[model samples]
Target: WNVRKTSNKAIHGVYEGVTIFEAPAKIGLNQQAVGYVPTDEEWRFPNFGEDTAHGREFTQSREGTFGGDNGTKSVLPEHKVWFFYLQRICNHCTYPGCLAACPRKAIYKRQEDGIVLIDQSRCRGYKKCVEQCPYKKPMFRGTTRIS
Candidate 1:
């Protein structure tokens, strides 16, 4: 999330600080990797890649099919094959379009922390916020009829 080139116009002049952290080693496909296991008390804290109340926050798509005309064999050399993944998340902009577009005023940003939140009680299932948001962060939940 580079703020300098972000699409959110409100934060165009704002400078956000970032701290880099080392990522966990990649695990082999279809195999679980050994790692830290939190206790019941510690489990209250959020863990990276854990399932959220909204289910998985991230979505993955296969860029393209690899391998063969024969259906199981690879025509390309093993050395030439490569894989890439791209992940997207909410930017939580200084001035969120979702907040402004919500006719019911369900979406709001906290002045103290600047975190944007939605009031499910106030939401009427109108998707104006979803239509206005450029980043596509405010997803509409059809099951609950809210955004």
Candidate 2:
């Protein structure tokens, strides 16, 4: 949701190698502390020769370059990078609790909707949602990077 760190801003992820990008700006955005976090939708798929999975592989800027240096810095206006993370990727919610609480009856699911949504207008930002939400979905954006 919102930033959980301030002093030690670390942009972390895992990748086998930089053979191809799941998306353009995958590196620059990540380096710039952009929001698009890798999901199953943006992963390195299996080989195309095999029938496991199919995905296009993009060409790199140059040959022989294995990895690029992530130039991350404090986004304190004077710094070079702005730290940010998008709170959209739902990790299988394996018995998620956020779906378990909603006194306003605002948060609901639709048979055709196929996804859980929160009614922002009803959200009092009681911040109880922050606690109940194991993933901390209810984040309020602000200047300071505090939970």
Which candidate ranks first by lDDT, i.e. highest? 1
Model 2: lDDT to the true structure = 0.39
What 10-residue stretch in candidate 2 is worst by lDDT?
Answer: 40-49
TM match of model 1 to true structure: 0.41
Against the hidden reference, what TM-scores do the models get? 0.41, 0.33
lDDT tens per residue, model 1, 45-75: 2332355332333322253323333544223
Question: What is the per-residue lDDT of model 2 for residues 2-84, given as tens digits with 9 covering 90 to 100?
Answer: 57655454456454554222322454322222122222222222222243222232312244222223532222122222233
Query: How far off is residue 116 in model 1, in Å?
Result: 0.5
Cα lDDT, all candidates: 0.52, 0.39
* C-alpha RMSD values across all candidates: 20.7, 23.2
Q: List runs of model 1 lying over 4 Å from the truth.
A: 1-89
| Clash count in backbone of candidate 1 | 0
